[model samples]
Target: MDVVEFLSQRIAEDEAAARNLLNDRSVSESGKWYERRVLLECEAKKRLIGIVESARQAALAAMVRHPEGDTPWIPEAIEWTTLSLNALALPYVDHPDFERRWLGT
Candidate 1:
């Protein structure tokens, strides 16, 4: 799927995983450290989604403003930002919708 869809799925998974961690019986034995870490990861994913969405919006505006493709740098910037975002998806390499290009594999 597209980046937005993929990131959304990942964010949901992270939220679910965090919930499960909180519900686990071993939490008392493990302390709150792990739970906090998981929550942080979920938050980080949310932030990444926001940033990527903004980048996408900027790219769309740039395209609309330069329909003739006169500004080549805009596309290059988009490509670089996309690749950077894709790299963040490496942790989800096994996901069914994960694209191999994300890993350059």
Candidate 2:
């Protein structure tokens, strides 16, 4: 497809991922800590969704105005999307025993 179409698709994917994170219901509210953690995650996802959507809109607008030239907002969109994806990755990856050691207290 064209550049605009490609970017739009990527934006949609980002939006979808954010929605999924915010709407997550897999973890039941077993305890105070667990409930608090889930709420924090949802809030984070909401903020990420706003950032991604704003960047996507700017990129789309730029593409519309300058269809022949480079879309300047594309970089910002990519950056936000990358940050969002990075946040989804497991933290403390090298230390597989992190949670066990840290949370088992």
Candidate 3:
């Protein structure tokens, strides 16, 4: 698939994972502190999605502006998509604040 299509699919997958993580009752019921932290993480994921969407728009605009020319915008789009995926995965992986707040460390 093309870069744009690949990035779009990645973004969709990340969004779904974020939604599932946020809605997980086991995580939510960990503790009061954990619940609050997960809520914050959910908010962070939402913000990341906004940022990714903005980047996607910019990339599309760039592509349109240079339709028959060099495709330099693909790199930017991929970078943004990667960053967004990383942001979405942060809560599940490692982060001091996430550990302290979500895991009650």
Candidate 4:
């Protein structure tokens, strides 16, 4: 497969692994272990975001290099990047400080 397709597959695999780790029951059974797992998951998610962003940038660069091509993968790259960003934001969704800062009265 081409570079964009390869990158997409890699991102999918990484996301699946992260989800598996997050859902593992062993990590949930102990308070300290759960906290550590959460931190590790957060770090994994951050790294995945960086990977997706880099892939998107590479895809954009490829499109620039081949402006006349179909460039069909751009939309997928953008969607994945946006999904990752949204996921990264989810842990903060219930934070009081975040709510106060962004949804102030």
lDDT, candidates in the order shown: 0.78, 0.52, 0.56, 0.58
Q: Between prediction 2 and prediction 4, which has the larger lDDT? A: 4
Model 2 lDDT per residue over 1-105, tens place: 322333334444555665555467663445444545555665665566566667767777777888886766676776665455444333432443223332222
Span of ten consecutive residues with least summed lDDT in model 4: 96-105
Q: What CA RMSD would candidate 4 show?
A: 11.0
Q: Judging by TM-score against the true structure, name the best candidate.
A: 1
How does candidate 3 score on lDDT?
0.56
Candidate 3 per-residue lDDT over residues 23-96, each given as its tens digit: 77665555545555645655665666667777777777787888885886677685667556554544443422
Candidate scoring better on lDDT of 3 and 4: 4
- Per-residue CA lDDT of model 1 for 1-105, tens digit only, reads 776678778878887877887888777746557777878887887787788768867987988998998877777768777886787788888888898877865
Show where candidate 2 strays beyond 4 Å. Answer: 1-30, 70-105
Q: Which ten residues in a row have the lowest lDDT in candidate 1?
A: 27-36
True-structure lDDT of candidate 1: 0.78
Would you estimate the TM-scores of all the predictions? 0.81, 0.43, 0.47, 0.50
When summed lDDT is taken over every stretch of 10 residues in candidate 2, the lowest stretch is: 96-105
Q: Compare candidates 1 and 2 on TM-score and give the better one.
A: 1
Better of 2 and 3 by TM-score: 3
